[model samples]
Target: MSTRLIIMRHANSRPESDTGLDHDRPLNEQGLAEASQMSQALIDRDWMPDTALISSSKRTQETFALMMDVPCEIRPEIYLAGLDTLLPIATGIEEGKTTLMLGHNPGCEMLIATLCGTYHPISTATCALFTKDGPHWVLESVLRPEALDRFKRVPYEVE
Candidate 1:
């Protein structure tokens, strides 16, 4: 059976905080605001995931937390990950009715570009939605923060 994947970049964060704890950085003000807005859009658009996987980073963890009732798994390899580190996760996923993969970029953008045939730097909180057709997931549509605000339909919601 096809397993859908929704890849989301962690919200804005203080990457330059004096705290050297890369895994402890919290979302900045804008990040929290964006997360609030996106959370609503996701709810309105019915984009909730049954299962969520995240990089074992602070920012990613916070992003996963904003969502409701999503069981989360932490993956260290996903931190500052590249496509290779992400491909296996996408291909190996099983048992989740719908899956949310939250992590950093360029890995997050790179993975979606490789699988979806699109390219962008993936601004914080951007998400690329993919649907599993047969044995592989296909790019159904893309949504950024601006689009989410405008169109809260499913992943295929048009501009």
Candidate 2:
């Protein structure tokens, strides 16, 4: 079995002025809804992770809380972490175990590019799912809040 990696960027957060510190900014109302929707999307796809590596920032914490009820590690080092810092953590996951890493971007975006050799924008509340393929990682799916409604089947309207 291959290992699955879910790289997610934290949901939309309040401005730094509101919290007086970037680390303390919490998710806004829209973020709450986005997080909830994404949570259901993950459950519907049966992609609930076994373990979650989350950033210690308030927004990231709130995002995860609204998403999954799984084992998690809150890492202070993950705040605004770069690809170099994140790569080792992601690569260290045991084979056959799915792990979710919730952090800020450009680190998340950089990690996805380095692993998949393709760049995919990871906006607020965006999730990039990857699966190990032999010695390499392949991009499996990307879920964004704006595109979630596209999955629904709408009845055709009679002209």
Candidate 3:
């Protein structure tokens, strides 16, 4: 059995708005639309998550709320968590299950690099798919909001 993981960074947030605190920052209009679009793309690909683990930040929570139809667990530790904190949560996932994680940057991007052995720039609302085979995690694909436009005309395949 293969364990699939979809890791996504929270969508575009209103950093400039007077939220007064980073954790309280909410998703902007673009973020909401982007999350909805990503959700549709996942549905089209039949990749809807069975379970999700989300950071407790408002932006992450709001992003997950827009994109999910399954049960989700909020982990407060994931807010700006480092690779050490993120990897264990990922590796502990049982086989034969698909898990999605909505998290913040640096940690999310670093965790992806640690798992798949390459560092890729992770923009807001970017999702990376990986398949775990035994102890190794293999990169399956990555989806971004900007690519959605092209995907409508032609399927995007990661090389």
Where is model 2 poorest over a 10-residue stretch in terms of lDDT?
Answer: 150-159
Model 1 has how many clashing residue pairs?
A: 0
Off by over 4 Å in 1: 150-159
Off by over 4 Å in 3: 16-19, 150-157
Compared with the true structure, what per-residue lDDT tens digits does model 3 show for residues 9-90? 9999997647598999999999998899888878777778889999999999999989877999999999999999999999
Residue pairs whose backbone atoms clash in candidate 2? none
Q: Tell me the tens digit of each residue's lDDT in model 1 across 1-159.
A: 346788889989986655778778888987886677767767775677888889998888887777556788888888998888899898777744778889988898889888866675678887777888776667766666655554443343422
lDDT of 2 by residue, 1-159 (tens): 579999999999888736498899999988998899888878877789999999999999999999989999999989999988999998988789889999999999999899988788888988888899888988888888877754661221212
The collision pairs in model 3 are: none
Candidate 1 local lDDT, residue 119: 72
Error of 2 at 153 (Å): 8.7
